[model samples]
Target: MADKMLQGKVAVVGAGAKNLGGLISRTLGADGASIVVHYHSASTKTPADETVRAVEASGGKAFAMQGDLTKVEHVVKLFDETIKRYGRLDIAVNTVGKVLKKPFIETTEKDYDEMFAINAKAAYFFIQEAGKRMNEGGKIITILTSLLAAFTGLYSTYAGSKASVEHFTRAAAKEFGPRGISVTSVAPGPMDTPFFYPAESPEAVAYHKSQSMNGKLTDISDIVPIVKFLATDGWWITGQTIFANGGYTTR
Candidate 1:
């Protein structure tokens, strides 16, 4: 069997300034991969720098990059800088997303466009650029929401936008397979992040916790190992959305 260790590999983590993305970057860096930590906004720069510092402190090489991934040029620049700095790309993980809990009736065109731009369009270009830049045996993972599997309402734009990533994962897996690249998505349940709290009510948060095991929301810790696996030994499992939501929702 091929060794799955990440030592000496190069990884680009999109939205890697904090939360799940931050953890993934640090985890992989600890395992010996050089990291390109990409943050989306100026406010995220500190966290991005912190993540890079953690990586370097772990004895791995790292640096921070900033870009609005909704723009293809920015996406291109992201990968371009990764290759320019690292000399090779081995893993790409995208955690860029925006959530909206408005009713479909109340959702404006702007809301829908912005949701798709961040969740769908950005994801597509990320995969496209990664495929172009990555060497053989590379891995690409995207963060999606388990809401994609739920039979519910009130998240029409949120869920609907993320749903598009499944197909992108499938197609990328097929196209990139011959080159020894693996593509996949990880869908976490209602995570206990600021990102989730803003869009959810207290009642909805409680309900989400009840549906998962241990009566708690998914933590960033819960999802990172699964992503790390996909980037390493779990390479054989591609073209699928793996739900790591503690049984919050399943197909």
Candidate 2:
């Protein structure tokens, strides 16, 4: 217990039932933080339950909750419930996002709205709720994409929607600074996750693999350590998007 980096802390992990989010929830819980694992749909509830069980099985505390984070009220409830259960929030990591890879001309209004709603809008309000509910010195992290730094096509909506969160992170960092809350985003390259594979074609995948080191896609494992650092020891690093893409994209 004395060695746990986040002993006695509490965290609200958005979309924390699977993939990178699930790993984060488990990692934070292992570090001794009580966790609120949030999932978006009924289909994900089982994974949410599994995550909660895994967390507790690791000798940490955690529970599962459901919400459509695109709704501000749901986002609020996420934090509210975290406090209700754990009585404090020391960290929040929002891994909520939707990706699209369609020709700009073929993209529709519905496509753009859905992308922005899940990627940008949800990220914005997640930060808002975290800011309001977290105790002093808390941290907030959003998952962005390294495509934000790429001169690529077919990802206009996905990249565009995530672009908004960088600004939100910067502003929130400044506004939350006085309260000792650090806000930041982590941009990983095309990750080796189900969330990524469906959006990419074989040719696109090969090309993405070529640009990064090791001829491989980013792993959720690679990104999780950075998130952990930001939530704990990396407190001074705020208001910036750290690209953890293995040289996939820079600047």
Candidate 3:
């Protein structure tokens, strides 16, 4: 891809205030895409501002919007606001997820509902709204966990909820292919972020590192290029969940 492959495009990054989401937002913005950096709450507003400033400093355009995407209305508003701000949507990336490491029997009703709400329901609606609002030949990407490919204990709800998005991506790919839209998911192995460490024990972290080819957890840097690729030059690869966990897990 060229240096500014995403130049003149517009992207909506869910949970774009910090961490992997923040990195993706900044990367896309730096690549010349006008970014709609969607943060989940007021606590992250400052980071959202920083992300926007970072993009602008890099010679790109961006603005931050706050919303709870678990509610379908908020998901709709995100895209609507993106179009309102940027006039069009060319790419949508959702990195919103929650992790839990409890046995199935120990999980509560509230836990299951919350997991599915953000991981599955929010994902489905995000894609739906994006499809409805995006310009032709747009890209839709979701960040998932490598546990989707693992026969692991615990994480029953975390993995199970994210598991639904693989199928959602597949179906969305076909349904939206006629419009030149590409929908795909990226599943990384025990990523090196706050999102990963809290749910893991010290021993579990060691085990995750052992499984990867480089004996390290996946980094946000490791995945940003993949998302950028799918959003630009790699647009042809649709409906597939790219397992980007080094050798951690594969199907």
Please tell me which predicted candidate would have the highest lDDT against the true structure.
1
Distance from true location, Cα of 166 in model 1, Å: 0.3
89-194: candidate 1 lDDT, tens digit per residue: 9999999999999887999999999999999999999999999998989999999999998999999988998999999999999999998899999999989888
The models' CA-based lDDT, in order, is 0.94, 0.92, 0.92
* Candidate 3 local lDDT, 126-237, one digit each (tens): 9999999978889999999999899988999999999999999999999999988999999988888888888888998999999999999998999999999999989889
List candidate 2 stretches off by more than 4 Å. 1-4
- What lDDT tens digits, residue by residue, belong to model 2 across residues 65-91? 999999999998888888888888899
Better of 1 and 3 by TM-score: 1
Q: Tell me model 2's lDDT, rounded to 2 decimals.
A: 0.92
The alpha-carbon lDDT assigned to residue 99 of candidate 3 equals 91
lDDT of 1: 0.94
Clashing pairs in 2: none
User: What lDDT score is found at residue 243 in candidate 3?
Assistant: 90
RMSD of each: 0.8, 2.1, 1.8
